[model samples]
Target: MATAPGHPIDVHTWSTPNGWKIPVMLEECGLPYRVVPVNIGRNEQMAPDFLALSPNNKIPAIVDPDGPGGAPIAVFESGAILQYLGRKTGCLYPADERARVAVDEWLFWQVGGLGPMLGQAHHFRIYAEEKIPYAIARFTDEARRLYGVLDRRLADREHVAGDYSIADVAILTWAKYHEKQGVDLGPLPHVRRWLDGVLARPAVQRGLAAI
Candidate 1:
């Protein structure tokens, strides 16, 4: 469903990789939206009102005034939000079945593998008070392996999937944090090239600057 005129989509988010995904999408689609900061550092996501919108208590939930059948709808989860926006605007998402399948595979890969493994690496290597070498090594290694997968995937193509779909945007958010994930891009040339190109987008810059 398309967003209503004068009633921009409400993006409940913070300054995070997941948080930046929605605004980047809205910017890419030229959809009007306003950021409603949910300061995760202050535990604001646990608020009852926010919880009603996002049962998972995630930072990047959205409240669309114009949803299916012209009703309001709230969507949680970064991957689902990307898919919703993609379908809503028909911008970066492909309509063709086979192409869409390709996009979904990489999108789910980011949500299930890349994002989480990199997040774990960040937590263990940077955020955790008691840094266990085992945990740090485990996640960092996983992060490196995931980056290797992406590097290989981009060896022949420009984007993660067929085109610059939501999959690229999803993976880009996490991949940009390679340094913090204990990964050196020196070994992953393709990823560095892809990341550079994605980061050069005006919409992405604006979305990141918004938060």
Candidate 2:
């Protein structure tokens, strides 16, 4: 089962926003993969085997048996995984340096800013044992501000980077969880339109259903 002829990707992931990115990319690339669930709630992500693939003790790592030079490759971080898949498949990720740079900008923006802000909003608003108003407002405001940036970016374009690349995949995964972050898309018509367009994609639908 480790080295099958057709199915070479073994996606070790959970059903989180970060976890869903890889599957969405894989599906978008038309790559065959098998999902190995990592139960983070039960500390499964801290296990030795899972940690070997994802040293950060995170879900959504992948083991690609047919990597560069036909060797296996294990990658962590949803952003890194998306970049690798785009490079390997020659899809989603642009070959042109300028276009690739554009994609990287939005992809990194989601990773460094959007995801963390939204995650903090979710924690303070939902998971935290003590609901601190200061923390809640801080994160919620940040999330709203970030959403405004994204909304403006998409005002004239269908996608973040002017084309539907991994940038859209990365951002939409977190954006789709707006309710959990206490986000309101009603005022951001451009973001709402872009989100609706991304959600309507057949690949996105399949990726969201992967888990």
Candidate 3:
């Protein structure tokens, strides 16, 4: 469905995993919203208009015209955006308190851990064009170690926690890149299974699309 004029939402994003988390959930919940791609590679985030919405000049910010008080709510952080949409749509984030926290824990784990580690690794290993051995080892090892942490946590669960909540949605697309880096999945049987579960979600597929 198309978002009506003065649509409830306007999402600024790139086609990144961090970027896709919100859209995937929005699409999954069938929410009507608009997408405004932020070309981070071209320094578009530095523009005055984008910076006004996201002072940090980041992608994945959102403006909700029909927010809690019917005022446009500008949200910057990806996790914050996910939570905002969850409360608005009443899905993705679990309703039960304990389950919700568990999901949030994993979300934080990725946002604070896996995402940064892998991003650094990608910077030095792929984008830099300079070998930068120390940086590569530092990032790649951290990414591997962090993946181990997740692999261990997933040993007994199908998803990151009890149900398929924002936790899974937050981290899935990013983790999908591990295989391309020669990161071993053999030791992470549980993580692999968990990933399979996440991959099966229709929302995940829709979210990863180049919007």
Cα lDDT listed for each candidate: 0.91, 0.90, 0.81
Q: Sort the candidates on TM-score, descending order.
A: 1, 2, 3
Q: Which should have the higher lDDT, number 1 or number 3?
A: 1
Model 2 CA deviation exceeding 4 Å by range: 1-5
After superposition, candidate 3 runs with Cα above 4 Å error: 1-8, 180-182
Write down the RMSD of all candidates, one decimal each.
Answer: 2.1, 2.3, 2.0
TM-score of candidate 2 versus the correct structure, residues matched by position: 0.96
Determine the C-alpha RMSD for candidate 3 after optimal superposition of all C-alphas. Answer: 2.0
Model 1 agreement with the true structure over 30-146: per-residue lDDT tens digits: 888989999999999999999999998988999999888899999999999999989988989999999999999999999998988999999999999998999999999999999
Candidate 2 C-alpha lDDT tens digits along 68-123: 99889999999999999999988899999999999999999999999988989988
- Inter-residue clash pairs, candidate 3: none
**Candidate 1 similarity to native, TM-score:** 0.97
Q: What is the C-alpha lDDT profile of model 3 across 36-132, one tens digit per residue?
A: 8898889898999999999988788998888887766899988888888888778878888998889889988888888877878777888897888
Show the lowest summed lDDT stretch of 10 residues, model 1: 1-10
Q: Total backbone clashes of model 3?
A: 0
